[model samples]
Target: MSESDFTVRSVPMLLSRNKSQEWRDIVLLRSGMLMRFLKTHNLLINVEPFDENGNVKDDLVIKKSHLTDDGLELFKKVIPGWSQYLDKGGDVNNINRLIKGLEKIRNQ
Candidate 1:
């Protein structure tokens, strides 16, 4: 798909009325067929913090990062069309677009 096809819009992420809400740009990475996989699996992107000595911290956090070799392979197998987008550290612009699209879809 072309870049124009991946345009994203901004959306609000709010939790409570008394608290301040965070806003971020959103994009849609996958739709239609891929949605089923997402619904079935509780996949997590694990990130362990490390100190200057390269030792992992005690607290592990769920965070986003570039996919590992195994992760890339699995992702490609699941969504071939989107595999390219995950390469080269992924397209930040397109990711933003995807998030927005997802937000729109969720609201609908």
Candidate 2:
């Protein structure tokens, strides 16, 4: 109803923080309730913790970057300006804007 209602202290967060059944139970219970409130009466804001990437996307995921070194070398012939940013620690996620909708295609 108000901003104060969405504060962390107002939430029923599970105390457990591990890869176990207890954690899974907490997520399942909370996520379901959150969805029902949204779909039924449009009652509450969907502030659930699970993210667009399932709250499990690791940027350092072994193959998260579809751009391989060899691919970049060949791509350099096209957009050479990307190297200036990429070489300076620019994130590939940031470059996805240049990709229109091709970003998801590459990730798969």
Candidate 3:
């Protein structure tokens, strides 16, 4: 599959099933799924196993356009409120506050 086709297939799988509280895990899972899909379609380049330290042995050289398109589509579906929560970066205190605020609104 082409990058676009891989992206289309992967995003829905990610958006439909994730319950991770960590934003980093969410992104990693999305990226890993996309990479796996690309590999399955024989579209990825220089596939390598992770090292003992759990780092990729080689760099993944994908175009920014493909990455941007895939990430934007995935986030749009999986985390509609992600930007509102992550706009300030690693603001878990604010995430807590925001959740409480939404709870208050919901209880009204």
Candidate 4:
């Protein structure tokens, strides 16, 4: 998917002033789901871990967009069965696929 297709919008909250913190929390909570979706589409470019304060924690980066053949092979190995559960089509299948994929990933 393109970056534009994945854009997240902000909503005004009457009771919350810490929008940055809220965004970080939301991202942290949904990171796994986002990773799964990216893997399914073979579009995962990089994964950077961060602390609660949004500080980068590690230097390990996987830029699939710039990967060579060997790098792609390694990435595939690292993310085995990445899109194995993504073939189901309709709305029901889509929901089932997501639930099953999340359960499998969480279990692992």
| TM-score of each prediction | 0.21, 0.25, 0.30, 0.24
**RMSD over all Cα atoms, model 4:** 11.9
lDDT of 4 by residue, 1-108 (tens): 563322221122311435577555443333444344445544444543344555433232334453334334433443233334332222212335444544454455
For every candidate in turn, the CA RMSD to the true structure comes to 15.7, 18.8, 13.7, 11.9
What lDDT tens digits, residue by residue, belong to model 2 across residues 1-108?
A: 532311221122332345677655544544343333222432223233334745421221111132334333223332344435544666533543235223433455
Candidate that scores best on lDDT: 3
Query: Number of backbone collisions per candidate, in order?
Result: 12, 0, 0, 0
Runs of candidate 3 with Cα error greater than 4 angstroms are 1-21, 47-61, 64-108
Q: Mark the 10 consecutive residues where model 3 has the least summed lDDT.
A: 55-64
For candidate 2, list the clashing residue pairs, or say none.
none
Question: Which of 1 and 3 is ahead in lDDT?
Answer: 3
Q: Give a tens-digit lDDT track for model 3, residues 4-98.
A: 42333333344446665564465544345445443443444443323456533233334324434333333334334533555546442333433
Ranking by lDDT: 3, 4, 2, 1
Which candidate wins on TM-score? 3
lDDT of 1 by residue, 7-106 (tens): 1111111112234322111112222123223323323234323345543332322222323333333343434434356544565334443344344444
Model 1 spans with C-alpha error above 4 angstroms:
1-30, 44-71, 81-108
Q: What lDDT does model 1 reach?
A: 0.32
**Residue 25, model 4, lDDT:** 49
